[model samples]
Target: MYRGRLAYRPRSETANKIREVNKMKEGIHPNYYQAKVVCNCGNEFVTGSTKKDIHVEVCSKCHSFYTGQQKAAAARGRIDKFNRKYGIQ
Candidate 1:
């Protein structure tokens, strides 16, 4: 027994004709402009987006995963309680 190779399915003539008739009208879609991303660590880069500008808290420059510096983020009250209960230094 031999397995048959997969074949490409050509588009139907009616589908092609319908696509030609139903062409998209221009000037209706939203404008896509360049957006600037600013990170807290002073990293900035330009990218394409629907919005004109974007602000972010973290980026490749300051992210712990990228920088290899992990800092524990704990609330003030939670840190105090945990330290007091566990007597952690």
Candidate 2:
């Protein structure tokens, strides 16, 4: 025991062997469907998901970052203002 709790120990291979095939309960898990995704930029793709149809505002096809259309902001903060004011290199 360490830190008031028992430490983890690996079990032997024979001890970890299972005799029965464990199966998932039917009707309990959500049904996976070939989900249709529609983006606002008119990009469509099919993927597996619990939801049938999905609508998104932005996707990789039209996102500014993915499309390389993102603009870098000329962000000047207090440090920059101070440096410029004092003419610090």
How close is every model to the real structure, measured as TM-score? Answer: 0.54, 0.56
Best by TM-score: 2
Q: How many clashes (backbone N, Cα, C below 3 Å) per candidate?
A: 0, 0
Worst 10 residues of 1 by lDDT: 68-77
lDDT scores of the candidates, listed in order: 0.86, 0.82
Q: Please give, for residues 1-89, the per-residue lDDT of candidate 2 as tens digits.
A: 45787779887665555422355567899889999999999999999999999999999999878876554322446667789999997
Provide the lDDT at 88 for model 2: 98
User: What are the per-residue Cα lDDT tens digits for candidate 1 across 1-89?
Assistant: 76988889999999999999899878998889999998888889999998998999999998877776563443556788999999997
Candidate 2: regions farther than 4 A off: 1-21, 72-89
> lDDT value for candidate 1?
0.86
